[model samples]
Target chain A: MSRPLLVILLSIAGAGSIVLALVVGTYPISVLQVIETIVAPAPGVVHDVVWQLRAPRVLAAFACGGLLALAGALLQVLLRNALADPYVLGVSGGAALGALVAMLLGAGDTGVSFLALAGALGSIVVVFGLTFRGGDWNVYRLLLTGVVLSAGLSACVSLILVLAPQAQVKGMLFWLMGDLAYAGSPVYAWLILAVLTALAVAQGIRLDLLAAGELKALSLGVAVTPLKLAVFFGAALATAAAVTLGGAIGFVGLMAAHAVRLLGVSHHRALLPLAVLLGGSLITLADTAARTAWAPQQLPVGVLIALVGVPAMLWLLGRRN
Target chain B: MPGVLSCRHLRLQVPGRMLCGDVSVTFEPGQMWAILGRNGCGKTTLVHALAGLDRAAGAAVELDGVVLANTPRRRRARDVGVLLQQEETEFWGSVLDYVLLGRFPHADSWTGFSREDETRATQALETVELAPLSARRYVSLSGGERQRARIAQLLAQDPRAFLLDEPLQHLDLQHQARVLARFQQLVRDERRLVAMVLHDALWPGRYCTHALLIYDGGALASGASREVLTRANLERLYAAPLAEVSYDGGSYFVPHV
Candidate 1:
């Protein structure tokens, strides 16, 4: 797709999904009613539902969706594997472990988020330490470390849940479903920082030569050591932010970025930017469907993404093969 | 400083393996030197060590006597260029874009490209006869066209020395000749030197000034290509019948299969 066209489509689609999410609530409102609620003041019931209730929820969905996509895109570039989505291998598990431990220690919701970020970053560092040393880093070792760490975190989350207070434990269950129910615009503000970090990652498309294999990237002056460090940290941090705030949303990164690459866009320079736009738009649409499908009650946006993305991806795959 | 490259006491170790042990060599300004060897005899390893891409425990290599090992990375790139074996054509860039990546070392930190760099890159593409295809996407190119684009990238780097590993692996005979002939001209006109590893001996005799046959473990012979490629050496190197026949002031080796 042309860059301008992709951008235009995303803008139109994203705006449409957000508006649709706001209007199609339990007590459905007409387009004029929704427009008036947004632009002017429709006092009383319509006003409360539009501004206070649905507005925050929709913004949270957008933010979370964007974060998942961004994280996934960064990880795909760093790991050099199409199958490597943000939630795959264990980054989300690592962050969830951090949040779980903090919550167990009586930290507030915000503190759990901070803990989750720390946990994700720490696990990445540990994985690097365990796997990297000699001339070429071992890919299999890195994957093994991720799997082990993920399993360990899952165990810890389970153990803590086994021993926690009933109220706190119940809260953790809802949080783990990857929902955007209690989330709002405040979390969206934090996600802006995540997107900025992704913008920093935009510099890393110079790494395509490195992805061709190490020596080639270096010959092109991509500085292999520095690139590895920057990519690992950049991808991991972006992923952590999403996992902490949104829970582990599966396959957003893996499927979307790979789909972009499968379209014959091999270089990260064009591929990452396109993947970012597509991922953000896809998540926005998915979140809109999740909220409006059941009126007053909301299905978790993460589940909705899986339900929609998988079938769409399979169909795309079928067309390709 | 005027000629191609020089090497002294280079040793390379990999965890438990010693890839190249205590090697010293120097390249004349504008000639091709061929290193002939078997699979594990460390031809590519030696190339990487010399290119300064692989960190080794050996002695230093200097490009134009600048001690490239200690020089800043950006400066090192300005002096040395390498053409590796792998051909990854799906770079998602135009022929111009891929070739221009050779100019990356010269890029200013912020903006990343300069007009001078673009001119050099376009000239390089022209030199490789890829100027007509500059706007074409890299993925759309055939293998031979992609090879020329890669060579064009190295040319744009405009280094004093070229290090290539298996440079003629996949090309047709015509492309192989074009690539080799152009490389030979780099010495005559520009005084740039190239070090290469070839699967055949006749290419070095035809275009290279120096031929160093590495057999068993180390340098077997080093001199002008004609002097170094003897029938006795060919018998030992390939363990087959090789007759050196000469015609029209050129030499070719024919193997009896």
Candidate 2:
């Protein structure tokens, strides 16, 4: 199929999945009722559920997924490693630590989100400081430093989990498992997602050169230091925003990029957009299943993603081999 | 548009050893120079230094009397292009897409590649004889084909000066000849400065106008190819005896048994 047609089809599939998510919740709202509620609304239980609750949740899911996938794609190219993702660089761990600490201090949702963003940025600074030397950025050294720091952050998270009061344990677990129930206005998330997607797509050519290698990109006229900084910050900010809204959702950030590559969308110009669509669809679908699968007893979205994404990615890898 | 690339008071050193020290040389347009040295003799390091990809204390590389250190990376790229010995193989994309990356320094917008960029990339592929494989995945190509594809990418760059490290590696005799002939034609027709690290002494003697031989202990000998590429210089550079033979009015140096 042509690239444009494939992109259109993916977009349609993503929109359809979101619509299905809005209509198929436990309230038994039909698609027609959902459409009516969207187009012409009256203040009712269905209206409140569709517009105030489900719509924002679904939108948050889509934005968070898109952010994660775009971050993953950029990091993969920047690090020249197929396995790189937002979490690989310890961004999510740092964000989670910050959010949990805020919750422990009895801060509100907004405070938690701000702290999370700060922590994510902090991790990026620490990683760069440790790895970058004399204008030389070694990928292997960066990878090692990030992995070690992630492990350190993971230990800190475990220490916090063990020390938290019993009353907050369930909430903390839910957050760590990437629950979207506490997400604020989706407008902020959606706007950030749109802006970031634009910036990343604008640098699509630079990303292509980067994937070849840092030296190759530099020789090709890419300002390697500035481009690396841009990608590092771009991926970090996207992950921070996603974690703030959806609490460190996994799988989408790591798997969505590889999944798109498996489908033969290799170039960044196509990869970035397609990964966003597919990633948004994946998380929206996962969040919907998380809410409705057991109905009345909602599971964490991350649980559903891992349960599904691991096997799917494994299958893709097996087929490729 | 003819210009000169000159390095003054250049020095490069790793932790324990000096690669090159206080080396001064000038490369002019309409000349193809070969940097000849034994393995691990800092030929690659010198190329990187001259290309401004590596910065050493007290080293100064200038182009047409303009300091290279002060030139913006993008502007310098338009005038000088470098090809490393190692090429990235993990990138997944069509050869055409890969080659079009060379047009990045000239692109006006980020939306897409322009028509002129595509035309240049296609022409570069034709020059490298890889036009038929333009649609093939870069990772799927053979070693020689990959080398040619990279050469095509550099060709698409169309810089005034080129610093290539081991451009002939992985190439068969036919490709080596064809690519060298193209390089020779480029230098002759357009007066571009082409400096490359080479292992084969015969190629420099037959095709190159100048040679730079890296001697032991961070010294350099550079001049007209015929003057600097003698059997005595080859023996001193490699610390091994060499036999010189005259073929077609050119001298070829071979390691003596």
Worst 10 residues of 2 chain A by lDDT: A312-321
lDDT of 1 by residue, A1-321 (tens): 455665466667767777877786777677788888788886788888888887776766666666666667665555666566776557777777887788788887678778877888778778778878874566667677788888888898888889988878866765666765545344544456455544544564466555555667676666677766766666676676666666666767777667765554545655665566566667667767777788667677778888888998887777742
Residue-level lDDT for B134 in candidate 1: 98
Chain B in candidate 2 has what TM-score?
Answer: 0.96
Proportion of native contacts found in each model? Answer: 0.34, 0.68
What CAPRI-style quality would you assign to candidate 1?
acceptable
- Model 1 lDDT per residue over B1-257, tens place: 58557778776455777755666778878678998876667787778877887765233777666666677777777777889877432565578878877887777644556899999999988877889999878878887888888888888888778898888876788879988888889878888888999988678778888987767555556778778887888678777788777977887887766
DockQ, computed on Cα atoms, for candidate 2: 0.65
TM-score, every prediction:
0.85, 0.94
lDDT of 2 by residue, A77-101 (tens): 8788888988888888888889899
